[model samples]
Target: MPTVSDFVIRRIREWGVSRVFGFPGDGIGEFDGALGKAQRDEDGLDYVRPTHEEICALMATAHAKFTGEVGVCIATSSPGGFHMLNGLYDAKMDNQPVVAIVGQQGLNALGTSNQQASHLERTFSDVAVYVQTVLSPEQAQAVVDTAFRTARIKLGPAVIILPHDVQGMEFSPLTPENWVSRSSAVAPSTAICPPEDDIKRAASIINAGKKVTFLVGHGANGATDEVLEAAKKAGAGIITALRGKQVVPADVPFHSQQLGLLGSLPSYNQMKDCDTLVMLGTNYPYGQFLPKSGQARAIQVDLKPEQMGLRYPTELNLWGDVKTTLDALIPHLEAKTDLAWQDKVANEMVEWENEMEAQATLTFDDGVNPRRVFFELNKRLPATAIVTADAGTTADWYGHHIRLQRGMLGDLSGRLATMLAAMPYATSAKFAHSERPVICTIGDGAFQMLGMNELITVKKYMKQWQNPQLIIVVLHNNDLEQVSWEMRTEDANPVWSTSQDVESIDYAGWAELLGFTGIRVRTDDEVPAAWDRAFATQGVTLIDAYTSRNVPPLPPHITLEFAENTGEALLKHDPHTVEVIKDTAKAVVTEGVERVKGKLHIGDDDKRES
Candidate 1:
């Protein structure tokens, strides 16, 4: 006679909970007992122990996202579970499949104001796709099963809490007797196609409009090519949400590379003028960017209905698989659209191309811009290699600089854009994709945010398998360059950077502590040899370069517009560095304004040409 904890463990496994993240504590006492018991009873139910709760959930989220499987994360009581909420939010926003388990106080103690028994459902309501609290052991299976179905089928984050007392009680089975042998849950109909009328209306509206635009989001990930097909057929321009950027390549003429925050101007302006906005698979967050008056009819297509009208006004909401929805809509559309509108939009996209080239061209003089870094990295690395980056400036740099020439390979991190996930996530991605070389890039400040202890994981994997997938390059600037720039240029106090000091940790020494091969490059002259040694390492290797902190990135277009001052900004150096600060002063005072005056513009006469 086993307890509900036994069934819970079984259910977790059946849901393909291959990995569990978070700490063990008293709140999950019965859970701990059940896990220990399962180890004795079952042959291979090994639980993974992560150093931090946040790392654990992040690991689980990455594993699930990369493998297209249910990522399971577990935490005990309120505190540990709360630590996982950020990663849970990332999973939800990224549309990754995630199932969370939190330990609760016993049922009787729940209402007694027990120490660890808290209102977790209310806490997670807004962040998760689905959430439930089970009162009985009998209900645990159903609750877990439903959560699993929601996570796998909806491909969204879901949560379930098991009270300690329920874990110790046995009940009738909710799943089939041979649960482990069941097939995996497929994406539910709700995630793909919602209703019939909305679908027809969405199609009809697109059929009527002369100029159609497709706005993609995370929800529309799997159907990128199909959406492209519909765009090409309708002679429509494609615009992507921040989440959808990686789904569609920036190089495509029809694709709108204009995303929010640090995104470009073309897609944003194009959005303002379109006659029809065809939402393909995305639940874009910034409704403000969408037309305010419904002048541009919005034809929404997604797997989830709840997501529709969440951000903007929707004239036609079609619920179906993005791939299927496009197929359904294309038949109703004319075989070809009037190229007059499409070509006008295409010509506007030429601005994006000129901007891209301006952004990509790097001078030997400019020390390091994220865009330039990505440009250089692209040439050195193979096309199909994997990349993992922390949030913050690294995310911004990558978002602006890196072009997603491949498939659904994208990002992670909560909306706050917090940093320091690359190393840990790279460990998971490297293990998952052993055949692919995994690149983890982190800013100096970001590398210091997480436990330096986890570098051991990379060492362990390399020692055991002689794996070459892990390649971590720390963007070693002395301070948080992005924040420092924001403070100086944008007039905001620089957010506190996590960097230890101007001359921080002996990064090479830290790498050696964990059995990783480490190299430090003191000058730009050492770049080639340092990179060579890194590739020759037997285990996880770290390349720590001393970079110029004041070298602000000057994109071609931006630099061209502010030519004189651009050169001045590029020359500005951190006081401690050996860069040419005097040269910047001369350029700024002499003719910076005149250089800016020479630039070109059209449409508006407010000032310098755009």
Candidate 2:
């Protein structure tokens, strides 16, 4: 008879899992041995071992995001399971389907306070939708099936705690005499359309408003055409949440990129001015950026009923798949001939783009402006590229500068877990789509935390990819830039240099030591060339971009509070006060100049026409 571990592996394979991310330990030795045997077969699961258990979980989350498949990760019990919490939370918060299989101390060791014998089910309760342990070999298949099914249906993580001794036991098939249950590997359909009455009510509100805005999120991924069509019919301006960036093409005339601190000015203006608001698929967390509570008549459509009206007071809530709901609602919407609102939004977006370009080109006294690095990378990004960014100024530039084309895919830790997911996400994206180029943008603080170790994992599997283009862009600023800025803007506090400053490392040298191409960029002029060279390289390349810590990532709409707090912080005599003030002034002045230039150009066009 086969071992229970072998049966569990076979069950996961039957569920269509082609790859599994994991790390080996004695707690999971049986499963590891079974995996080794499985690897010898002609059609077997590809096992990817990242540097740590945390990375395994992060990679699993990325796999789900990129491939739209159920991501599976395995780890030893106790300490290994503890390390996976952060990454599992990443999946949970982002609403990705991931299954974590963790090993435990033997059943005989229970209640003895033995090694690695903690209550895993209780530990994983908050992070996972479902958590269970296989008490017997006969129950193994049912447990595995339920975990995968629950993960898929809940759109979150599921945990399976396998005891060490249970894995080596002989597998038993389900039968009438054994009191065992059988489960299927088939996945259920998720597409749902809202009721006709709800659809009509949503349509009526959208139709009656003179100025309308659509807030699109990740739920709108596959319904791009429907969203565009509905927007055209409703004559609405489109604003995407950060997670919904790829749902609609950035170049759409009526679309104003993203909305929030890392968002565009046009998006802010559209939200503030629109009389009607329709939110789709996204539960955007920033309530301050949204229209005031009674200012606009709101309608929200989401797959989860609980998510409906959670962000704003909606006149109507439709719980349905975004694409199906939109398809059903679109026919009821009367076509609007007045597209003046869309035209105004498009024009503001043009101005916003001009301001961003001006900001990107500004020179800094200390080092290369980080915006310039991302600005240059955006120009060179291929349509087939998959990009991942860490939480920091990297996310700032990525949100404001990078305009992902229709076919391209990009994501980060949506809930913004700093220094935890970027490199692992990129590694997993490369593994999932070996034919596409992958780019990871990370700050020095985050890169040093875990990214360096993941490079070894990259090197070990570099030859397995058909397309060997994985570019890691390191913004080598010797400070925790985002935290520093947040203190200034949110707390009116000066930079606490002792805690904020990061130890400098020769990042490019380390990459070169690992036998990968490494390029160092110091000046503004070198930014474009460094990106060019990284893209041109046939294998993994790391661009160590020495960037300024002083460049402020200005919010789209700067309020009195932000201005006052920044001024107070500056008055407190921060170490980089002079540089910060200078950089901030330059960015502000550049935007003013760009706005004036745009007006003058328009005036000139009017004069010629007259």
Which of the numbered candidates is closest to the native, going by highest TM-score? Answer: 2
Per-residue alpha-carbon lDDT of model 1 for 349-433, expressed as tens digits? 6655445444444332434434445555554555556677676566656655555665425554634455666766776676566
For lDDT, the strongest prediction is 2
The TM-score measured for candidate 2 stands at: 0.97
Instruction: Report lDDT per candidate.
Output: 0.65, 0.90
lDDT of 1: 0.65
TM-score: model 1 vs. ground truth: 0.80
Worst window of 10 by summed lDDT in candidate 1: 598-607
For model 2, the stretches where C-alpha displacement exceeds 4 angstroms are: 177-179, 599-610
